[model samples]
Target chain A: MAASVRTIAVIGFDALQLYSITELIRRENDYVILDTLDEQCDIDSIDAFIITPSEFVSRFDLFLTKRTKTLILADKVSSVGMDMSVSVVAINSRLSEIEEAISVLLNSAECGAISNSELSARERDVLKEIASGKIIKEVADTLNISVNTVLTHRKNISAKLGIRSVSGLSVYALMNGIIK
Target chain B: MTLFNINSKLCDIIFYDSSVISVINRFGINLGVGDYTVAEICRSHNLDENFLIVIINTFLNEKYFPERLLKTYSITKIVNYLEKTNSYYEQFQLPNIERHFNLLIMKSNADDGNLHLLKRFFDEMKNELLFRINFDRQEWFPQLLQLGNTTLDEDIELDNIPESAHPIEDKLNDLKSFFIIHLKGKYDVNLCQAVVSSIIALEKDLKQNNRIRERILLPFERALTE
Candidate 1:
């Protein structure tokens, strides 16, 4: 049997904001766009409800959980309900981070895994070097920073992502298109 | 009586306007003259305007004729003067020397279009050698040998044409080697035939290279065969 065409509805008032997100996640094979504000426009057939954090929190619900995965394109965690829904977190208007967030949301939906968060630039630099199998000292010398500084970034990366090992960092990087 | 007669004749010749007198003393016929106009002078001189112009054009190129004076002289008069002065003679340099050879190459008689650039190459190489070899006569052979090293020197910062491999002494050897190596470098041909063909081609190519070689690639056949 032929597969169904996956449809996605982008929800945003700002054209620029929508442009940024669409530009990032525009390459996905199984997606189409629908209106973001059309709430009752058949949530049953939709695979994911991607909501802006501001929009999602305003319509926050407890029982309105788990028809499809819910993702919030948010800068900070604002609302909490008892039921589990994924949050695609980005940081202070970082464009690259926002792109990573959309890609992570799409991947998580495919694998039925947890949502991923944005990486800081230093964390990304350290992860890239670490992924290349360079030792901490070598990465430090190349980056022109102290080894302790690299260690600090690694720790921050681990704490932020809940991944402890460098191998885990490599796996995360590969999965999310972080390092080549 | 004879001494007194000689002095009297000399004074008469010097003092009076003998423009009317048809008097000849020695080797040549002297045309007794009267100044009227240039047209009259030319007519009395039996000169053609057009023919005299060509003669002036040709003789004006003689090194001895001051250019300003040549332009001022009626072409016919200049031609007349030039003929009398035997100004068309060529000064020959040493026959076997390179400069003399270059002069021969430059002259119209030696140019066969095919041999023109070989002539130019000889001239350029001679000039370069003269300028480069600057010391007294003793330094001649050594300086010639020194300039023969055409390899790029560290002192030269710009891109330079690779030096001709054939130094004066080893030109024949270098030509032979060039023939051997490049004869069939591009196409398949027997060594002897290819050598002959490539040398002919390379000679032509080197000539055209100065004018338009940068803009267009000349065909191997034209350089070689014709």
Candidate 2:
């Protein structure tokens, strides 16, 4: 199954480099690239920022870029320097490394939404309880369902989502807002 | 250290430090399981003895975290433990502080305006601290536990979680200067120190939580990825 489209903005990458990153993301069809961080672009709505060293002037710029999902390109030592806030990558050239970096960042970004079209209400409850760290018996007790019924719901949820492990379900639950 | 021989009661962990009752509560080990040895009670509850020991140690001594010892525990367990610690503040400690703080305000024998300001600022700071904690409980901790679990087991990798915001630390420092130091110059040195200690203790608890996350849990998670 495809992930929900991630909206990304590229800043300070030269035209050729910008084309490469956006092309890579769009080829996957999992990301929608905006031309620039413009007035139409809600600062909060922008999912990730891939900014190059030449463009990286201040923390203020990235602070304005987005909150959580930022990838800074560093050649030697960028203006952001050793600041532990935003991720600073050493490679400025390789598109594959760039793609891998972007994927890792996006995956870890805490931004991205999951659609809830397929999940039933019961499945949603089970997901939330499991994700919030409740064990199966505890979840059964809380929901006032039979333990076997809770197990059945969990199995159905895993089958529908193709995510079997409790940890995987937990990630799905969090990403999909099945749990707070 | 509280010893637990076969004849010893299971409740000594709580008896040693009443706060520890909250920690064990996260493991669903209810109080008053009489005279069961530590090993016996752990077996009865099906709680891993080593895991329980590490949790108790982490709660008692913030600096004593052994990341490898903590590896057996799951993300859910750690999150629950941290959440319980967070709750201890607003549920028990913060209310106790507020009660005495009200008494201090009522018994103010001085004509100073800063005392009144201190009362108001203290209330706001407590609210802000609580609000930040609630925000973490709802948003940050869920994502964090997922991140820890993901990076630990799968090929997926996540960066270190950004440190949480503690705006109240600055507020508490301001209180120290405006109210506590001022009180020392005025009449009640003991009262000033007592309230200051409360603020310091709360700050310490929050900081220790941050340390446990950063030091023990994150390292353990990273090691799993490795």
Candidate 3:
């Protein structure tokens, strides 16, 4: 039997962006967009919530319900540049990236496990460098390795951590204390 | 972390001076966890609020404090750890830059960074907090009334006491002093009437930043003596 189609809700301060993302999502899957948090919302029916940056922090406590999945989009997590706990789909994200994020969320929910334990020390070191706000080439130079080495380490790090996306890696590194 | 750990960490990464270390150490001890409020610190140390203002101004000087850690520590676990330290404000150390961070909002605007420095100074008041005062006042009032020489009466008068109009330390201290003075008094009708008005003002000012006000001020008021 085919898996049931899932519905995702896009919520944010930007109506145009919300509509666009919802349109893109609706084209590929069963989904809906909420213009605002209102009495009309069926809180029990939403499978996931994609919250924009400004809305994320203010409504974090309210929308972070146990039954619903959440994704946050922001420039930086905190003033100190510390990491945040939720996944972030960047504002200018590509379609493939968004689809991958949705798939990862579904897979993680289905598998009941998300691992960040398979990374090697070198791969972790590279991740730490990346976490400290360094670019891949810069990280490569600091580690006294080639640019290709750094990219390879990053790819390996993501796979081992059970996160196949850059945004996923960023959130993972932040929440896990692997990066500040 | 204490000035010592902060100093040691910087010394490990960059070179600094003993004079700066001494200054930071003294400042750390001054900020040590004691029964301190702005009034108490000013009275016991025989220092004017201007002196604290000067210290804060001096802290804004780039040569006096490093700008990097100042910004980073504000929104991180560093401030949390620093509060727990037995010696936080005794001495001063510089990491590298000249800047300050606003602890309350965790923002580091570059212009006159006085707001940021004052925010950290206010964070010092967190040490003595005992309980929060809110709609649940009836439940907590009995516990506190029992702990001190206070009477839990609904008719209590708070006329002479100044109401805290803001979440700033000065206002919080004023509110604390008022709470202390009214602890054992019988509710005076005339005074009770004014208190109701002040409570409304206090509630309005507190609504904007309830979490911070609750975490810092309410507990500190509870810890104050009658």
What's the DockQ for every one of the candidates?
0.00, 0.01, 0.02
RMSD to truth, every model: 35.6, 20.7, 24.0
Model 3: per-residue Cα lDDT over B1-226, one tens digit each: 1222211232321133322332233433332425444334455565443333233323323234322222222222222222222132211111110112222123323343333332333233332221232222445434433444432232333234434533333333332333233122233444434433333333322332233223332443344544
Determine which window of 10 residues in candidate 3 chain A has minimal summed lDDT. A76-85
DockQ for candidate 2, please give it. Answer: 0.01
Give the candidate number with the greatest DockQ: 3
lDDT of 1 at A157: 57
TM-score of chain B of each: 0.19, 0.66, 0.18
- Higher-lDDT candidate of 2 and 3: 2
For all predictions in the order shown, the interface RMSD in Å is 32.7, 21.6, 20.9
**Candidate 3 segments whose C-alpha is farther than 4 A from its true place:** A65-67, A75-85, A93-99, A106-180, B1-226
DockQ of predicted model 3: 0.02
Put down candidate 2 lDDT per residue, B1-226, tens digits, no spaces: 4433334455766677665665666567877878676678888888777667766666667556556545456777777777877787878667766876776766667664446656766787788778967987998677667665532333234356666554566566555544432342253656666676677666656665666677655655555546
> Is model 1 an incorrect, acceptable, medium or high docking prediction?
incorrect
Q: How do the candidates rank by DockQ, highest first?
A: 3, 2, 1
